[model samples]
Target: MKRQYLFSAFLAREKCLLYYQGTIRYVVVTADSGERIQLGLKHFQPYFSALGLRGRFRLTLTETGAFDSLEQIN
Candidate 1:
């Protein structure tokens, strides 16, 4: 079963990638749109929620792309 989640993110430079359990999956944003990043959290919701992550998550941009470190805020 695959689940999809849509959420907004703030990237360092608008370009980023999505990582699930140390594996990169989706590219969230691009350098041209360096403001806000929208992520399509697909098929990895269970893994993400398992780590107690829900709602909006923070993203950090690196040379590769944007990644969620699974840090949740209440």
Candidate 2:
């Protein structure tokens, strides 16, 4: 079944590409339902830094549902 969720997250880490000087972003988020969702930055764009990967923010997503707008919570 499909569902919507609101969660808090941090830019946990990034994987460096050997060929390109870019990154594959990742985040660790604790959902409002107390579930953890770790994923890549296919849809998110949070500011990242070595000492600031733990920036806490909030986002919303729909799993197999509608793709609505996501927001960052302060």
Output the worst ten-in-a-row residue range by lDDT, candidate 2.
Answer: 12-21
lDDT scores for all predictions? Answer: 0.40, 0.51
RMSD of 1: 12.6
Question: Per-prediction TM-score, please?
Answer: 0.28, 0.44
* Model 2, CA-based lDDT: 0.51
- The most accurate candidate by TM-score is 2
Residue runs of model 2 more than 4 Å from their true location after superposition:
1-4, 12-23, 49-56
Clashes of each: 3, 0
lDDT of 2 by residue, 1-74 (tens): 44556765544344323112444455456778798776555546444445334444445456754545455555
Clashing pairs in 1: 16-66, 17-65, 17-66
